[model samples]
Target: MAARNWKKGSFTGLHGLESALGLFYTRHMFRLAHFSDIHLGPLPAISYRELASKRITGYINWQRNRRLNLDHGIIDRITDDMLAAAPHHIALTGDLVNLALREEIERARLWLESLGPGEKVSVVPGNHDAYVPGALARCRRAWADYMTGDDGRAPTGRTAFPYLRVRDRVALIGVSSARATAPFMASGHFSKAQAKRLGALLDRTAAGGLFRVVMIHHPPVRGATHAAKRLYGIGRFQKIIRKHGAELILHGHTHKPTVHRIEGQNGMSVPVVGVAAAGQALGSAKPPAHYNLFEIEGEPGAWQIRFSRRGITDPHGEIGEVSGALLSPGK
Candidate 1:
């Protein structure tokens, strides 16, 4: 039960979360789990063939890629373990598919469905989820019974962006940064309207004392190494965070386990955390398929984030804690 040694104010490039932490106000406490890049099974060989036939598939060279590491049993086990920890809620960033295949999307839905019911799980779509014209909508349709009941009804027809999942003490702000890239670009961009809407949503939610946890597919900031500088419009995303405060930011595009502090305009540091791929066989020091468990406590407006690493088995295994963040404290 010992906590992992965490620096008081540190930022992980989980997503380019740059919130300026001004005065040190009282800290709120909350716990939740974060995982990303599921890349569910029954992958399309055609997509691989298509990638192979072509020189490249956006930023990734799939021709050289060897495998799709989404193990169903492993994922299920991890979910079971995380649930045993009894987190407040779960946040899935994106990349829930190897390709936007119908079967894959259906399988993904089943997988998420097997998890806790509506009040327990929140998810967003990644580029692969929305690669096709209406791929995202299809996935949403399949999971509608299991996921939140947004009903895909927005003022606009685009259900791809600005989805909400509200639990007991947390509100998951699911944003769609998934966009089909043209050959060499693997980056994503949220349209001006989407960004504006997201900012406004955060503002409203924050004012209402909701713990807003923003989830997206791409990294909001640059990678630890400059090798992946293809960061698109991350600066704008950071500005949105500054405009509105968030408790924790979670993402999984880069697949590297990193933690960072986003500085809010108010000079308060916001904690952004990332998890390595929960997909099977990622070839990392830790298990190829691992998920993060957060121990959250506190009332609405005030919550804390404590990070824990969980493997496929050993649900209650104490891997250790990383860092914690305070959102809004209930008066």
Candidate 2:
């Protein structure tokens, strides 16, 4: 444990004068399981292709003709394994449904509720959570039932971004970038109001002398391989984070694993992590789906983020390491 001052109360316009519970002075180190894109639903079909029927690869096409059942048991199994690891916290980045059905949202709630107590699990709404246009509100309402608070609205006025988990020496800040848009377009965007509020919150949380984690459903940086039409307001989003000294940013809209480096508000390199969807099975061209386990260690303002994967244990399973800028704390 390092000897340092852990100040309670707000020191800035963000959380100034606010009372905060302090943990005994010690090194804050814990493991976090970051998983996203569960797409849990009343998803009853041989495949997602039959419902809305999107263009799938030739392999999935063959699999669909085979009439295999879409067993979501895999999701439950993965969740069980992740919880069994006893991570300090679980960060789910959203898209827990195939479509935004009321039943789907309800089912997602039940799934999240079954995870554990609210404090141990933190979730952010993804684009699919908004079943219909402006469904984010509904998604927020549904998940609030699982969290401990007043209607799940954060002081920032966004229900998805509320509730700072002040456990150990880490403050996990949750955000929502999920929105309903026209068909054929799947992307996420952070409103100007939300971005500003997030910056203020990050500033206050960082000043509190705890490791600051910013969680969202969309990638903060533009993905090189992402379609231009599907890109979110990631540029402006990253600008706010860089300006606010966010150490770790977690997201999971893109199914494939993505990690990027963006300049932080404090001139430091912030690591933006994107976890693959733990829900989707290997359709055709891709490997089996998996989740991420991140172990962070070090003193305040200086920590190392180590990333690993779980789910597929087969000798030839599609598990690998996250190297380069993504593996290191500072890109």
Which candidate ranks first by lDDT, i.e. highest?
A: 2
Q: Whose TM-score is greatest here?
A: 2
Candidate 2 — which residues are off by over 4 angstroms? 1-26, 41-71, 145-163, 228-231, 315-328
- TM-score per candidate, in order? 0.73, 0.77
In order, the Cα lDDT scores of the candidates are: 0.63, 0.66
Query: Which runs in model 1 stand beyond 4 Å of their true positions?
Result: 1-31, 42-72, 145-156, 224-231, 282-287, 299-302, 312-331
lDDT of 1 by residue, 109-155 (tens): 77786776765677776766766556767876776543453544441
Put down candidate 2 lDDT per residue, 52-168, tens digits, no spaces.
433233224325631232235657767777877778888888887756666677777878878877778888877777645646677777776433332344322453454466667
Candidate 1 lDDT (Cα, whole model)? 0.63
Residue 19: error of model 1 in Å?
41
Q: Which whole-number lDDT from 0 to 100 does residue 184 have in model 2?
A: 57
* Candidate 2, backbone clash total: 12
Question: What's the TM for model 1?
Answer: 0.73
Please report, as a residue range, the 10-residue window in candidate 1 with the lowest summed lDDT: 15-24
